[model samples]
Target: MNDNHSSSAWSTYSRTVFIAFAMIALGLIANEHRVHVLGILPWLLILACPLMHLFMHHGHGGHSGHSGHDHASHQAGPVQPKKEADDV
Candidate 1:
């Protein structure tokens, strides 16, 4: 049982070390290509707008169901002046 516990601890330690190394490598690579990344940042933002719009509205069913959305239904015919009690 003690040996098994040690092996598990070692496994966890190795995994953590591997992740640390991978992050360091990725960071270095990203630093080297930062200029290229910045160059494409604007295009990425533009592309994300439409992609986000499509995905964000997907849950509530797109604009097709909103065809009846108009101010006409909300307006109670022409407004009439209120009659004064004194006039009555």
Candidate 2:
């Protein structure tokens, strides 16, 4: 049913948002304090992961049909043939 479908969609969306926020939170915490061991690198990397994902996945809306061509140039009449004057 439509209701079930919508519910599932909402749940998925909520989960994704939660995970995104959690990643940011962890990153912020890591940035606040330095870890003595090599583990800090991995933690910072984890924080950057979500940002990379977002930028890589962001979508631009579809383009209109007019984008590819120059409408004005097409509207102009075809080039006229040039007549050469006869040699005197």
What are the TM-scores, per candidate, against the unseen true structure? 0.50, 0.32
How do the residues 1-88 of candidate 2 rate in per-residue lDDT, one tens digit apiece? 4655553645777989999999999888877665554667788899999999878765433326436555555567988999999998
Q: Of the candidates shown, which would achieve the greatest TM-score relative to the real structure? A: 1
RMSD of each candidate?
Answer: 7.1, 15.3
Candidate 2's displacement at residue 80, Å, is: 99
Per-residue lDDT over 1-88 for candidate 1, one digit per residue giving the tens place of the 0 to 100 score: 3655453645877989999999999999999999999999999999999999988986452356666555554545978899878764
What global local distance difference test value does model 2 have? 0.72
